[model samples]
Target: MADEITVTVVDDHPAMLVGIEQWYAAAPEPLRVAASGATSKTAWLPPGDAADVVVFDLQLAGQTTPAFGELRRLVDAGRNVIVYTMRDDEQTALTCLDLGAVTFLTKTEGADHLVSATLAAARDRPYTPPALAGALSANTSSDRPKLSIREEEVLVEWFQSESRDLVAQRLNLSPKTVTTYLDRVRLKYANAGRPARSKAALVARAIQDGLISVDDL
Candidate 1:
C-alpha cells in the first residue's frame, strides 16, 4: 500500500529469483522485492501485508504437487498471484486458473512478456497470453484439443489399466462415456501427428509431457 507495487517471487532456483529481482530493480516504477523463497517454509508471507503481487512457481524441489493451496491463500486474501513456471499443459493451466491465479506465464515465454504480465497483474487485471486465452476459449477449435474433466479422469484410469467397468464405477461415469472419452483421446493424438496406438503409449506421452505423473494415475 505504499504507492509502489510490492512483489514476492517464489522459485526453487536462486539464480532465477535473483534475475527476476534485478529485472524489477531496473523497471521505471519503484518496484519493491519483498520476499524470495526456494521452499514453502520460507515463502509464507503474512496475509494482508505489503505484498501486492506474488509470482509463484508450481513446482518446488522436494515437493510433489504444486503449491496451489498457498497460492489460493494469497488470492483469497486479495493478493494478485502470477503462476510462472515451465509447465504449460492445459490441465495444469486450467487448475491454476481455477485456483485464482491472475496470470500464467511459461518460462519459455520472453522476458518482455513476463514483465508485461507482472505489470498487468499489479493493476488487478487478468494477464494470460493471447494464445492461451484463445486456446481456453475456443473449446471447439480444430487446432486445439479440449478434454472434459471426466475425460481426463478416464485417461488417468486408462493409463492405470483399470478395467472399463471398474473405471466407470470409480469415476461414476457410464462405461459408454468412458469409451467415448478414449476415442476422443485417440482423435486428439492423431491430430497432433503422434497418435497413440495403445493405452500404454498414451500414458507414456502424458507422463513425458508433465500432463499427469505416474503417481497421479
Candidate 2:
C-alpha cells in the first residue's frame, strides 16, 4: 500500500479543525493529522516532520487577506497548500493562484469535495473546483473585451435560466437583446481564446470571475 498521507490543517474555527481531522481519521489509507494551527503564530515544523498537505483558511480572524508570504514559505519548504476559505472573490482566487496555492476549495463545498481536494493536493496535483476552474480560465487574457455592468447582468441572468425566453423575461429584455448579449459574450471569449460554449461553461466563467457564488447556482 502507498504510505499514509500526512496533513496539517490551519483554521481559526475549532469545529472546522476537528471536522477535518475526523475526515482524515476515517480514510481507508493511513491518513495522519500531523498538526493543527489556528493562527500564524504557531511554529510550523520543518519539512522532515512537516505535512505533505496543508489546508488553510485564507482569512483568519485577524487577517484581512491571505498571507501569501507565509504560504510561500511552506511551498518553498516542500509543502503543498490548499486554500479552504469562505472568500470567493475573483481577485482573491487569482491572487491565491499567483501565490502558488495548489488548490482552492470553498467552505460551502461539501466535505467529500474537501477530502478529494486534500488527497489531490497530497499527490501534487491541482484540485480547482469545477466551478472555479471555468472562472479562472475565462479571465486568463488581458486582451479580452471588458464586460459592461448591463452586459454582465444579462449574461448572468441568461446563464442562470433554463430557457432563453425565461432569461429575457427576468432581465426585462427582449429575446433578441438577450441573444445579442450572448453573441457578444461568445465573441469576447473567442477573441480571448477562452470561448464558453454552453450555459454551464458560462456559469463556470462567472464563478471564476467572482461574479457569482458556486452555492448560488
Worst ten in a row by lDDT for model 1 = 190-199
Every model's TM-score: 0.58, 0.60
The lDDT, on a scale of 0 to 1, for candidate 2 is 0.62
Give the C-alpha miss distance for residue 128 in model 2, angstroms.
2.2
RMSD of each: 16.9, 11.2
Per-model tally of clashing residue pairs? 0, 1
lDDT of 2 by residue, 178-211 (tens): 7566544543443343221222333455566554
lDDT of 1 by residue, 1-217 (tens): 4678877888899988888888887877777778877764444545325567788888988888877787766666566677888776766665565556666677766666667678766764334453334235433535555566765667667545435688788888887667656544433432342221222343455466554556744
Clashes of 1: 0
Q: Rate the local accuracy (lDDT) of all candidates.
A: 0.62, 0.62
Error of 1 at 52 (Å): 0.6
Report the error of model 1 at residue 65, Å.
2.1
Q: Worst ten-residue run, lDDT, model 2?
A: 190-199
Quick one: best TM-score, which candidate? 2
What's the distance in Å from true for residue 96, model 1?
0.8
